[model samples]
Target: MTSRALVVLFKELREALRDKRALSLLALFVVMYPAIIGFTLNRIIDKAGSPEREGIQLTVVGSEYAPTLMAQLKQKNVIVTPHAPLDEQATTDLLRTAKTVAVLKIDAKFVENYAAMRPARVELWYDSAIDNGRKIDEVENVLREYTSRIAQARLLAHGVSPVTLVPVTVQKYDTGTSASRSAMIIGAMLGSFFIPAFIFCLSTAVDTTAGERERRSLEVLMAQPVSPAQLVFGKLGAATVLSAVGLTLELVIAHAILKWLPLEEIGLSWRLTTADLTFAILASLPLCLFAAAFEIALAMNAKSFKEAQSTLSFAILVPMLPLILIPMLDLQTATWMYAVPVLSNMTLLRELSKGADIGLLHYTLTAAGSLVVALLCYAFAAVRMKSEKYVLAV
Candidate 1:
């Protein structure tokens, strides 16, 4: 059994190495994917790290706290403009005209409440229609942080310890290692990008293999004394190796770019160790196997080359759905997250990026499960190929 598998693997590798199309595709990924990922990552970091001010004009209505707040805003490089009648109606009008990016309305009892050490209320009015909800959230966060600091200072001046008000400092202790955190972030980002590529590659690869079978060349090869299972395994193995090579190149280039990108300037370290790279490869292996197996089955079942391509393209939609939704919701990697097949790989990648240690159980289970699925997919394809109807349908 071992010898047969080895022979099959070797044949597939040699065949893949000699195939012009396969070589070109692998070379393309080696050159393009890393450049694309590196450029994209650099752009993202640049946007976030930019120190340029937006020059947003903030209009303050009826605030007794206007003087202090305005000074603070100026210090933060925001232009403050005092507007008349700090009422809701005037504030609304200002926001509508874009005369003010933000409007601040301090309650009438702001001075009284501060003197009494009571909780004071403040209102910020902004156009929610512009630039999504993020700008509003940013303004609110700034206000909250500023207000909290002032309240804490006042309490401290009154002989009250700030720790007395909030005694317990909540610290999150994770059982997982640093690799896990890094994997979680890196996995998600890379998965979003690579899974789609894997799915697409599978479609193309299957069209090259099983689609050829539908065209009769596959049968010509199978009849040459090799078993159908061996033939199918060979094709799958070829696809896996091509995928791995492309992915490896992308990893190497991305790592080199990250090493010199000065990520620490933006409060991040994009460094990855040898162990981290191994974990990333391991995490990706299952997805690659699944892609190959699934694509082979789809292409085998397809009536034409076009049909195989379409089906494989549609299969990508499933993985892309999570890729889109996960980051929007800002979901973090957790124990349960590591069990969700493709999602687990993505989460693991992200955690690996942040230098977190992935748990052995999680790693082992993900790889094992994917391998099992891949094997089952191959077996199913083999069984279906034995059917005269299935073989002749294409």
Candidate 2:
């Protein structure tokens, strides 16, 4: 808080700004992550909206033998293409291109078997690796319906009730709303957006602590009138500022992309208003502080910049644990979840996206949880810097 601390703060900021690699990395992540998230969601929308607009691309061999089946497929929105008989290898190659959903191969004995009231075989050929599973499933559904209809007609012709074959009928209904479903999917990604908070501050945190010591100048700075707490606070402020600004810009760009995307087509939503988004970014600043403070605490122990960077590299994975694990574990949102650092931010953002009514308690916990931990880390770094052993080593 002293003028000397302010001087130290401005001085560190200037040095960080001069580091071209750090600035470039900051810019790269600011743009790169949002673009990737948008691209992924856009692809999901396209895939989800495909059936009604594009229909299935099915290649049929020996189509003349089954006119009724071809008509039925057309009615079900299948684009049937007549083709010559293909060997197994040819079918495999065709499926590999992803041009066709599947090849419908009518058995040579189909007509003979049908005329004799026997079961006729029809094979659906497709590559299991292809991403068009929905299209293949559609084709199979139509085949099942066609078979059912033939059996029904045969039963009627023989003076038997068709309803006798179907003892029970099952129907499906989805209870989950689109917003709820999308929250889970988007929640996993929200943590990744904030990871840059730690990354953006790494260079400054390492350079200010371990790097200064390695350059034999940290002792000179400590010789000044500034208290150890003030010195750590100044350096912490510099790193936190850089991290917060980069993370804010990254979130802004991501917000624009997510709002611009048609997430509804994929049963997803990003319904964050400008006010909600502003609050989310503001609430996330303490997380940046936590990241910078955590980095500084670790970097303080390292003997050199390289050592600090390598050590902090492993520390980066720590924040990622909750982000990766919680979603996989399908942990329910508890009040206690709002008190866990990175997970709290994700839960808060997810609720905001879903337009949930967040109380002041959740917001307070989200900000306070990280801020408290940040202060603890700051206290540790300050105490470590003031220790006799560290001074003797320097």
Candidate 3:
């Protein structure tokens, strides 16, 4: 039985390799996904590492009224462009161009208000649609400092202590590191990694089963001395092997790209070593197997390749649910997460990326859960192959 299963396995693998379309699809995913991911991350890092005030252009309407404020803005490296007073429409138009981060509209009564010892109004105009929140915050901070200094000076001139206006001072401390922030972003992307395990093997699984049947070759193969169990094992094993190889290559390429890029530039870190990556690849092997077996079992029942492809395409979403929904729930990692299939692999990779010291038990459960499902699927496929109805349909 073992020898016959090996024979079937070798035959399917050779045929799969010979098919140019299948090989092309596999190669496309192996190279394309990682390259695209690396390019995007590199661009983000470059944009994030640029100096804050490097290209900041701020438009001011009335700068003569507050020479001290203008000096403070220039000292903070802000490029203040003086312009004629603009109406609401003009300010909105300027912000829409995104040429300037924000506009400062000094109230026309600013000098009079200050001389009369009344509250002054300064209107800060910004486009909320733009993603320049950090730059806007910097401008606001400078304005607040200027206001506080003026208020303190007025208090001292009136023979009152400047400290009388202050009640308490608050300081802020952030405990989160760049690594954790990077891990969150990477975790969102990692769920997509396991999807290819199902996709890369889709053509192979459908072709070997439904394609063979549609070509009137399945009956001839079933007449051989091999049992249904051996045939099912051989076909499923071939698909599983192909999926594993494809996923392994993807992981290696992704690891190399991540390690080579300067993730620290954007407050991100990829601390995975070669050994850790190798282990992660190995741990994810069963997920590939489970995907292959599940698809093969479904495809064997279909009457045509297209029918199987359509059905399996939708069925693939079942495993993807946890990957998509779990992160949105914002649920803390628990043991139960390890019991789910694709979600388990995603969680494992996320934890590893965060450099958490998850124990061996989590790894065992992750691999075991997928193995159990794969075996059950294989058993069902074998039983169906042995049935008289399936033989007649073939």
Candidate 4:
């Protein structure tokens, strides 16, 4: 940028600094997002580290009829609380109280059915919407094992081999490492870190271009000796500077929180070093630049602040779609992934956190892609400003 552009940059930045409301919103998001991410991971650690899962508390009716089954559940760390017979509505009501994970009702004729060699039904009632899936699964496993053992014993008494019921057994294996598994959980949220790159710059970008035009000050500003390039660069620079700083601070705070967290409790890891984090912050500057330039390109064209804000609000979602949808698609990470804007930054950070041995090529592609897009947007805005029709209209 020329010296003229530098003056314009400082002028806009000074004006922005005086806007306390915009600054406050920026500050709030900078701290708020990292704190939220930290709190979520901490909760996960607490849940995973708890032993016995608080004994998978179970409410059982007719417990006396299946003492052996109760013993089996207890052995598997299920705390059995005996209760009177509950009808369907009562059982549903009890489950809704969240006092226990599930209600197990042993059939009243269990003893009679067992003696007659007939099937005995055991009801396991649980609320599927509740967040006790693991406990429910444990209860079901124990019941299955208990039933299988009884069947095996009955077969032995009839002089039939227990193996006769089995045709073949298949063994399964999981190839996913701890890093990949951890990524599966954290990757869902990784996009949020880069999203601020777009958001923090929105106010400054929109206010400077469209706002000035709405106030009817733009024509006078355009009448100045400064070239159109200088004006465009200056405004774009101010927004980019704020966005870059905000994004960098957010990344550092998030990194500290993730590093402090006991993610290992849930088989997760934050494998990023301070040096790696620094590299990521530096590499992500282009995303901030891209965000500012993209908004400025659109906001410069709009006639008023509200028009700019409304149009940019919808237009911005076009770029962010990749950030929200790519993880859901679960596509394998490839070379081309580094060529996208928001996605590239997130992918780079996620890969780094997984301790992936990143090369310069990845960082180059990540930064270079954003830089190219940013330059294109910048060029377009400059061209728009320099247009003969635009000056005449103003």
Candidate 5:
């Protein structure tokens, strides 16, 4: 029986390797995805590190009334170069260059309004879309700080205590590990990568099984000396192994790409420790099994490859819905959340990556639950295989 199942596994693997379509899909998942992610991270780092302090210039384009503002900027260690009063076009041109990140456009009647104690507005012309919103934030912080300091000085001159300006200060206390916070965000992104990979596996599983049955090969296999259960297990086992390989490759790629990326600098400490990696690999077993079994069962119900693909695709995507919605909800992973399958793995991935110790009971329960579900699905698939109508319809 073992030899027969081994032979079946070998046959399926060989076929997958020989099939150009299957190989191409696997290559896309393994190679192209990593390349895109690596290049994107590299670009982000380069852009963020480009604006070094030495000789970095912010073009100040305005009339000659804001000498104090220039002095303030100079005192803050930023090199400010005074340019001739700029029109809209000139300001736009300055913003396009690497040297000039921004242009401080002073209103025409700035000094008179300040002397009269009236409201004054400063226009900062710059690109808000640069370097993942960092440049814009930097400019806004500088402007706000400068404005507040000036206002405080003015208030002091009028014998007013600046203490009244600040009504209250709120201090934040975080109970979470700094590493966990960073790992959680990166883990969310990693979860998205699995979605597409799982979709491929689900689609492929159904195509390999039910599609083969509809093509009349299943009867030929059943006519052999192997039991129906053995045949199904062989097919499911092959898919589970392949899915594991795909997942391993994705993790290796993620590790390599993240090596050069400055995740630590950005307060993201998303390194997968040894225990975390082991847990991730072990935890994924139930997920893959359940997904494989469900796809196989759906395929058993399907009359053709097209129908199976459509059915499995929709179901496989159900796991990804939470991944898409997780960012919007802004909720941290709670203990109860570990009961959910995909979300559980996602949360565990985050916790593990951040070096958090996960309880063995939780991991065991989740894995067992997933396995139970997969077994039930397998039973359903077996029942469908027994149905003469199903076999005859295909």
Candidate 6:
């Protein structure tokens, strides 16, 4: 019986390999996804790192009025571009270009107000639409320091204590690290990697089941000496094996690309060592099996290849719903998450990427949960293939 099943498996795999269209689809996904992700992350790293090398550009309208303040701004790595007084429209046009972080306009009565010990005003002009909040905050900090110094000097000259001006003081400290900050972005991306398991096997599963029936050969194959269970196993095995191999290759290539890129620059980390990657691939194996088995069962019910393709395409979303919805809900990982097939695998990978030390029990549950589901799907398919109704339809 096992030998017969092996024969069926070999035949289906040989036919799949000969089909250039199927092979091309498999190759494209294995290469394309990793390349796209790697390129995107590399671009992000470049953009995040550029600001330090290129200092902030600040446009000051009344630099002559506040030479002391202007000197203070330059000392803090700001490249000050002194400009003559401009109207609101001109300032708007300048900010729209995004050439400068912000415009600092000192009031025309700055010297008069300073000499009179009145509070002087400064207008901070910037395009709120742009993502330059960090640069703007730095400019504000410099201005506050300059103002505080002048206030202290004036109080001393008046023989009054500067301490009397402040009733309270506040300080802030951030406890979040770069890795934790980046984990959210990277976690979302990790969930998408498992989607290809459903896609890579669609062609093979559809071809073997619905395509065989459409060509009027399913009945002839059913008449063979092997039992229905053996035949189903053979077909399911072929698709599952192909899906597993394709998914594993995609992971390896993606891991290599991720490792090569300097993610540390952006506070993101892909801490998956080779052993960790191997374990992740192993845990995901049952997911590939479940994908293939589920698709095969759905495809077998279709009358034609196109019908099977369409039906199974929609069916693929069943597994994908968890991957998408769970992340959107912003739910934390829990024991229950390890029991939900695709979602479990995604959660495991995400935790692993974050360098978490999730125990072996979670891994066992993830693999076992998918294995149990795959077995049920295969059992249902085997029983359906042997039914009188199925035989008559074939």
State which candidate has the highest TM-score: 2
Off by over 4 Å in 1: 1-22, 30-33, 44-188, 196-204, 328-332
TM-score of each: 0.63, 0.92, 0.91, 0.89, 0.83, 0.89
Cα lDDT for residue 224, candidate 6:
90
Better of 1 and 4 by lDDT: 4
Candidate 3's C-alpha runs over 4 A off are: 50-53, 156-168
State the lDDT of candidate 3 residue by residue for 55-116, as single tens digits: 56899989888889999998887889998999999999999999898999888899999999
What are the per-residue Cα lDDT tens digits for candidate 2 across 285-325?
99999999999999988766788999999988977888778
TM-score of 4: 0.89
Instruction: State in Å the error of residue 261, model 1.
Output: 1.2
Compared with the true structure, what per-residue lDDT tens digits does model 4 show for residues 361-394?
Answer: 9999999999999999999999988875554534
Model 2 C-alpha lDDT versus the unseen true structure: 0.89
Clashes of each: 33, 0, 0, 0, 0, 0
Candidate order by lDDT, highest to lowest? 2, 4, 6, 3, 5, 1
Q: Which stretches of candidate 6 lie over 4 Å from their true place?
A: 148-182, 391-394
**Per-residue lDDT for 303 in model 3?**
64
Worst 10 residues of 6 by lDDT: 175-184
Compared to the true structure, candidate 5 yields what TM-score?
A: 0.83
lDDT of 1: 0.67
- Candidate 1 lDDT, tens digit per residue, 1-394? 4456556667656756666775676666666755776676677566554423365567776644646766666666566676566556766676788656777777778878877888777777788775424445556666776787897898788888778877688999767543444355345557654564464356346655556666787666656666667767777776777676666666676677767776554455666777777777767777777777877777778777777777777876766776788879987666877766677676666666766666787787667756777888899888876776665663
Clashing pairs in 4: none
Give the higher-lDDT candidate: 3 or 4: 4
Error of 5 at 325 (Å): 4.7
